[model samples]
Target: MSGLIGKKIGMTSLYNADGQALACTVIEAGPCVVTHVKTQDTDGYQAVQLGYGEKKEKRTTKPLLGHFKKAGTTPKRKLVEFKTFERELSLGETLQAADVFVEGDFIDVVGTVKGRGFQGVVKRHGFGGVGGQTHGQHNRARHPGSIGACSFPSRVFKGIRMAGRMGGNRVKVQNLRVLKVLSEQNLIVVSGSVPGAKNSFLILDK
Candidate 1:
């Protein structure tokens, strides 16, 4: 599947062709550079590495500096590899949002979700805790009740669903419609809420 790398620029409402106001998330999609192209014979695969977002030279390391220098491009904050794309891509080629997708195209967006740290079972796993609000139940309302057997196992299982750190995982939302593509500004307005917060990296694929 072909795709483009982008950054979430926040949400806004825009008018459709029918004059209906639609809520959308405005994203600053590519104008990305094809940093490297992997060939089947050489790299044992076919893929293109796209570079997005700019960064200062001081923020880049020596090894990355060398890599970007070889590609004849400035340092980018994110570099993502995309497989299953159209064949015969060359290095240093510029990819824009207009070229990858247009209005009404269906795409899959991949991003990392916002992190929620150290949560309880109720919030994390949607566990309906013991006791009702009508009854005078104590402070054990949202707690995880009785993890396991005591004398039988004597220890907690390895894969117990205890609450801890949540979110911050890679999520792919499929079949989202591209509402509009602003070519001049390199922006794209997609139909629904995407994963992650504003300014987060997003990968849009077919």
Candidate 2:
């Protein structure tokens, strides 16, 4: 399965046919335009390049301007390619949210996660530091207890979980159910939380 490019508009609750409130993620899927087609003979791969979201002509560079003009489309803010597309689509073709998905379908959503800068061992690595403040534990509340054995390796092994930057990376949430498809509003209501904050680019796949 495949999906058009979209922006996550956030999440909300909706009542199903059985009157149970279900949580759903609202994304503004496209009427994405096919900008270019990659063929096996030329590119050694098969894929379709899609353009989504609009930007002012002045904001787009001249190179991009020529590219969009070749595709006969206005300057778009984002362009993404979808590989192994199931449908036979062509350049200048428009793909809407309704054409890609339906209720109860499982999809994988990929996006950049929200950034959390420079976290400590407890928050970043989930380490339970020394648990008592009463026993002369001066400032070892969130410190990593023991890095390594006394003189076994004489140094900490690589890849030991440590505090550092968190999030702000490409993340894929897989097997999320499509709860609703609001074609009228060009919205897709998925079953759970997706990566990134509001209005982030999301790629959906089956």
Candidate 3:
């Protein structure tokens, strides 16, 4: 359950042995600072809190400023707690992306899907609207036809798929293979597409 907090940089393509192009996501993984350490005896749990990205002092609260100062680091933009690590980590210690992941590793990426605001049924639920415009169906093409029964359980049923809000939800894309780990650049290239737009925070878990 060890991982790092990363920022989705963008996507790129790579050619394999057969010269086939493969799409990959590029993430700026951490050179995160170990902000806090929790032990069973102290907090009734075990977790290592790491901080990533840089934020200004003016933007940070007084309490958070003190917390970062105690860790011997500057203000950070993100804080995440991991349950365990391959190696013991001390408070105030720094961890690079290469230290936690390697090439060929399969990792799960957690992120918020891009916000789509309000959407209709066709776009939201893959609904097959009234197929043809026959039978006086002039303006009913993309409608979610017939929501209720006549006098039988009268109300529209709960859990019936209807269009409302879409996206902007937490999602986990699992078992994406790690294609490359550029330690010098603090970047990790992973196979396939990742959720959310560029610069969104992602939790990469192993």
Each candidate structure's count of clashing pairs: 0, 0, 0
**Winner by lDDT between candidate 3 and candidate 1:** 3
Which candidate achieves the best TM-score against the true structure?
A: 3
TM-score of each: 0.88, 0.92, 0.97
Worst 10 residues of 1 by lDDT: 131-140
List model 1 lDDT by residue over 7-41, tens digit each. Answer: 99999888878999888898899889988888899
Task: Compute the lDDT for candidate 3.
Answer: 0.94
159: Cα error in model 3, Å: 1.3
Model 1 TM-score relative to the real fold:
0.88
Q: Which residue pairs collide in model 3, if any?
A: none
Positional deviation of residue 17's Cα in model 3 after best superposition, in angstroms: 1.5
What order do you get sorting by lDDT, best first?
3, 1, 2
Badly placed stretches (over 4 Å) of model 3 are: none
Ranking by TM-score: 3, 2, 1
**Mind giving the per-residue lDDT tens digits that candidate 2 earns over 1-206?**
45778999998988888999888899888979998888999999988898999999999999989988888899887888888677798778888888888888899999999999989899988899878787799899998888788778889999998889988999999999988898988888998799999999988886
Q: What is the C-alpha lDDT profile of model 3 across 47-160, one tens digit per residue? A: 999999999999999999999999999999999999999889998998889999999999999999999998889999999997798988899989888888988887988998
